[model samples]
Target chain A: MMRLVLGLVVGVMMIGQVAQAQNQPLRLEITEGVIEPLPFAVPNFVPANAAAAELSSDLARVVAADLIGTGLFREIPSSAYISQITDFGAPVQFADWKAINAQALVTGSISVSGNRVTVGFRVWDVFSDKEMKPGLQFSGTKEGWRRMAHKVADAVYSRITGEGGYFDSRVVFVSESGPKNQRRKRLAIMDYDGANVQYLTDSSAIVLAPRFSPTGDRVLYTSYESGFPRIYVLDVGKVQRRVLESQEGTMSFAPRFSPDGQKVVYSLSQGGNTDLYLMTISNGQSKRLTSTPSIETAPSFSPDGSQIVFESDRSGSPQIYVMATSGGEAKRISFGNGRYGTPVWSPRGDMIAFTKQNKGRFHIGVMRANGSEERLLTASFLDEGPTWSPNGRVIMFMRETQGASGRSSLYSVDISGRNLRPVQTPDGGSDPAWSPLQK
Target chain B: MNLVSKLIAGCALMALAACNNPTDGTDGGPIDPNAGTTSPGLIGDQTSPSYFQQAIGDRVLFTVDQSTINSEAQSILQAQANWLLANTDYNATIEGHADEQGTREYNLALGARRANAAREFLISKGIAGNRLKTVSYGKERPIEICSEESCYAKNRRAVTVLLGGLAG
Candidate 1:
């Protein structure tokens, strides 16, 4: 098996002098309100060998982009730097970085040995003049420098934010083109940063909601190949797929993988009524989860796999509900005025991201697992399908324009309801499902 | 499409009665049959698909997030059922669609419910279940592009598209 990446035990560790400037550890956690973004600096990663020269700056750029994109950290322009970092072991001139209002500093090195490359990086608390995190290194193929850079960025982000890193992840979504009425859709995968996009299915078949497996190797999606919406699973790397549902009369869609990745939960429409069903991926055996006459779909499993949260119209209008994985009476969690759907359990297991429609406008919002503390993160003409980032700190969703010339595109927002930004895609994108950080 | 094309298509259906008739209707007035034979369209031609579209109505509108058949929808479905019985060879693929107002999955389910609502209405009127198929495009397909309620009401619709060759 070709493992794409592996972490290496650094033979040489830079043990800093551990300067004392502040009592509290360096962190960028902001609660309840917006503040100025923390300013940081990333000098170009130094190429340790001649072979790594051309790609060193590119590596540093990706790291900087990942950190800046979060809206939590701002990069102090290199032009404003008083001192330049040329080596990984060079001690951080805290006074110089502090003079430029830099709270954190990052230094990295790229060493190439044939097709294999090793990347080592360190984060420094510029104010304290102490190491923010222990030095570490990642080794991978030269062609995968981007992933290596992402890994570095992930480490830096996590060390400062005290949260899991989402940079080293992928998103499976439907790439759309043409007009709103006659749209052409295909299954496409891309890096979380919208880089290295690769198509998984041709536009001949209409595809939607390409959700990633827990392991991030396979994807579950809905397609209209047989002139009916059906669930399908595709091996992302191989670009091979097969129909997961083949019932004669029923049409299935809105599929998701269980937390264990052993079973699938999807909605099956039979005789005009929709309900949720669980199917074992190994044996293709099925079990009915809900027997509701109302529309029951968009099932997402909790991180613990003990329960499933889904949207159902059993309460008259569509509302978020929580029921056991084994099935029973679902407790309605959303009691607000608007209709709520697409409730996704956050990976952190504390929040559920969802889509809401009220007063002709749509919103992406989050609430506690029990539906308390409802917070709308974004509102737009048409915003739907909230997908949590791997860290559960951000939510990505599709926003579509109105009319025949209208189109759909992806946007994301921090869970705090700040920093709403568009996620760039080559073509229109919708139904984004973010994968867990890649192994 | 742009405002010009949207206006033309809306005018063709007479849905936007405010638009001026191309056949020299004075200042946004109704079309005159005497001005041009084609201007009358195939509304009176009962045997044609255009007749089904322009007269009997091949589509029905639903209120925001509703699948229940309203009174007007019931009347139209009655006409549709009578037409289907008269035109025995026709089968329809009921395309259910939602406005850009809901989640993709829920809108898809909503569309399904709307399509099935129409299908059940037809079946109640003695149409065969095998002769009807349903698909929901959710918010993916919108006939009207405006973000306002005017266009949203039109986009929230279920259209019964006729297939001529298949005589099931």
Candidate 2:
């Protein structure tokens, strides 16, 4: 865990703002109202050598894509550029950018030596004619150029919005194929913006609900490989897996890690009833959290790990409930007109995102921790299993179509219920669990 | 009553047909003496597994999210109980499934309830508790694919899959 601190030591050159903005720096609010996207520009990064020429263009292209994809920023085409950055230390000509209505500008330089690559970038406030933040530099292996590009975009985003960025994150999900009756599912993972797809498990068995650990080192999922539903924990880097709960006769599923990644809370079914159970990850010892004759599953921990929010059917139909981390009487949280299930505590611990069904239509929704100000973010034929972004500003979930030809895909929406975008997978995908921003 | 009588008669006829060549009554295709389908191999010379599946009903239907046994499902499960009691050599694995209308986790728990409901019914009918095992596939394995009630009704089912010659 301490490696995170070391990873942040990327030799930041503490060069203070090259200039000062006479007014406030360029900023945008995450609002539901219709907003004209802030226009920004990123010309090709200046290459330090002939070998770095191709990477320089790609770095700039990736950075621009990451920013524009947020819907809060719009990319101003290079064709609209009046000045090209020939040097990394050159000053920006704000007057020319203002003529084209460019509110923000990003400039960077890339140099490659063998396998190591170094990048330096600065964010400029075009409207104020000054740099918004201190200039920063990042160095990494050539294979991680995309990551460096994303880091650049994240810095630019944070500087302007004064919030954490999510571009350097990944998502774990279930990949599906075949028909509705006999679908084959495999555990799969990919980048936050749907790049670098890699399969974690083959389709030999049905795997569902792949959730990333808090530290992003492992994944917990349910698999039916043993002729029964069981929980499995897999090391993402080693690509190895082991059954977390292998008690014969009883079945377990819907496993989610606690915030600190030291324990797991999941539903274990016995006799005819299902109840939630908590397990210590180190010794495989489990303790019952809820004793009821109803379906209780989809447990999620709050950011501080003092409480858990889960779905239970004690009131006849499935609804959201919150209970203490050590387990006791749970307080029902949802008072809506529908059945709520899969209640996930947001990373910020301020809201809980969930899947709800009302009048035959399924929706992805969110509510305050106390279950107030309920807002439905999406409504479709089938939408379930929501996972929050690391910053809690966005939620990515699964949506399925209807009829015999029904198929599911991953989708994401901002907490404001805007920028409803489909996250592309190589195949049909569902049950997306977003990982934290990687170091 | 009508479907019950018809099913009983069909079972008897199918049991007989398993041992003899079908359509080999007078004026039929060539009647090879050894052309009978697989023998029943029942220890007490009772019904075959196919007969139990097709004519005696090896499955029970559930409506929507409810796992309670209906009057119609009760009658079918009663027939299954009678057959299992007579055939003491086989254990059964009850597979429960749900339609794709709910969340995956809830439907899985729902499926387990359905299987256990059927298993409990059989147990009440004198089938040893150890003779029945249950597993749920949630909405993962649907026998029917359409989203309409026509298919959904069938997809939400509890199927009795017999484990050959294991129970005492």
Candidate 3:
């Protein structure tokens, strides 16, 4: 009887161990894979005063929009809410949100005092029935209410997605007008949502591409004002600019600052030949990095400043090539059909965002550093010049229409190839460069 | 050959007329009757006072990765030279333009090459070197509106615009 009982117990123990092994939660691996967006609800935040009600509502709407735009979350309609959020400090009723199929819930309170405003919010995981992040409070001047709301959204996004936030950012681009043959382009900057636009340069002279320095307080771009293409750097805050290094007998364009912001890398054309050159900002000393007869341009530095990915026709066609930042033999990184150019390394340092032309259609694509796993995010008649969100989860690029009445506009898409939409601009725009999230 | 024979005969008569009346008809009338010998040349030649106003259709298309002018561009240059010879007083500015296909900087270089090619061709055709200037618009301007090959073909061109009036 003892032996029989022991055998039965051992058999049951083995079976239980096998079941436990099978039931163990899978280790979450954050990589280049499909991630279903998390569903959440944001009830209208309550205002402390009547005068603060409208701004509170607007703030809540903007926050929701910003979170949903990241492609990592879906905002549940307020109408579907089972209960209202009357107090941000009160405990979240998990059942209320769970009943409505919401995995997360956001609730906030807005208070305005004299010339200052304060916003307090909390995010909760309804399924886990726990606070996902600490209760956050932001206080600023009444005029800075929108920025405070964006910061809160960024905090919530960072907590839930385990990635940096890009909502509290800005973009600098070229606003274009007139006909195709006589385009007048000006340098323009705006909030990430396309609000608070300010033109930095007049359209008197043609401008090509504008890139933001790492600090977001300056912009480097190419202009044709001196009867030749040359690079210029503008102080965004002061509206002052100076030509970087205008060498005679050579035309330069496609300027990008080094990650350290100490140098500018651009292409210079002389004797009917083009090559990559680097110019130090302090001394204006320029060095030729590429000496090939083949065309080399559109150079972007790696996040670590070790390598550079640029477009070169050394392969007999326009393709992306990677080389050491110190300049060496370049290895072709784009082998897929069609041509690829304008490669910008992501801030995360994992993938490169570029414009790919195949089958007469242009696509914004992301590929690993080694040129594997190419995934195209958006396609159009003309989609080029991709700039990455600070988190590297999204790409912003310009899409141009075809034919005589054609126009260019800004659009962004997630790396998962979803949420493609036009970013509103006061005018037609192109060559969008997303600035890092402001401090 | 037949047109050449007729032109030579006309030139002989004009020479004889100039010998008879050297100064009276030299100022206003057509002293050289051979100038009107070819109707197409006459009309085209009159519109341009110097080589600057003369339009020779001197344009070139670059290959996908090339900035060099090929053989077909040479033929266009030969014709441009003939037109420049007929109209001597014009100074020309060769504006180089590229298709919207390559990077902006590379296209600028490519456009410059196209302009240089045309400029060199004119110089080789015996046009004064100082009479020509070159500027490149890169891929900024496109004469064709479409994004297809047909439009690209028209965009890769070097246009010679007259800067000054022909010298009398």
Strongest candidate by TM-score:
2
**Span of 10 residues, lowest total lDDT, candidate 1 chain A:** A1-10
RMSD vs true structure, all candidates: 8.2, 5.9, 12.4
Q: Higher-TM-score candidate among 1 and 2?
A: 2
Please write out the lDDT profile of model 3 over residues A1-439, one tens digit for every residue. Answer: 0010001112112111111222222222235577777788878777877767877788888889998877667888989988888755556677789898787777777878887776777766677666654566767777667676787788778777677888878999999887777677999998898977999999988888899998888999998898678899999989899998688756788889899999888988775567898888999998888999777889999998888899987888789999888887899989999988899999989999998888788899999998999999988888889999988988999998887788889999988887898999988999999999877
Which segments of model 2 are wrong by more than 4 Å? Answer: A1-20, B1-46, B166-168
Please identify which of the two predictions, 1 or 3, would achieve the higher TM-score against the true structure: 1
Give the per-residue lDDT digits (tens) of candidate 1, residues A46-125.
89999989888999899999998898889999999999888677667788998998888888888999988888888888
Candidate 3: regions farther than 4 A off: A1-35, B1-54, B61-66, B70-72, B78-92, B103-106, B123-133, B164-168
In order, how many clashes per candidate?
Answer: 2, 0, 4
* Candidates arranged by DockQ, highest first: 2, 1, 3
Superposed by TM-score, candidate 1 places the C-alpha of residue B76 at a distance from the truth, in angstroms, of 3.5
Q: Model 3, A44: alpha-carbon shift in Å? A: 2.4
lDDT of 3 by residue, B40-144 (tens): 223223232221123435356666545566788776666666555444444556777887766565577678777777888878878887777677788788878
Once model 1 is optimally superposed onto the true structure by TM-score, how far is the C-alpha of residue A398 displaced, in angstroms? Answer: 1.4
Model 2 TM = 0.91
What local lDDT score does residue A417 receive in model 3, on the 0 to 100 scale? Answer: 88
- Candidate 1 DockQ score? 0.44
The TM-score measured for candidate 3 stands at 0.83
Residues forming the 10-long window of minimal summed lDDT in candidate 2 chain A:
A1-10
> What local lDDT score does residue A379 receive in model 2, on the 0 to 100 scale?
93
Q: Deviation in angstroms for A59 in model 2?
A: 1.6
Which digits, one per residue and each the tens of the lDDT, describe model 2 over residues A352-412?
A: 9999999989999999999999999999989999999888888999999999899999999
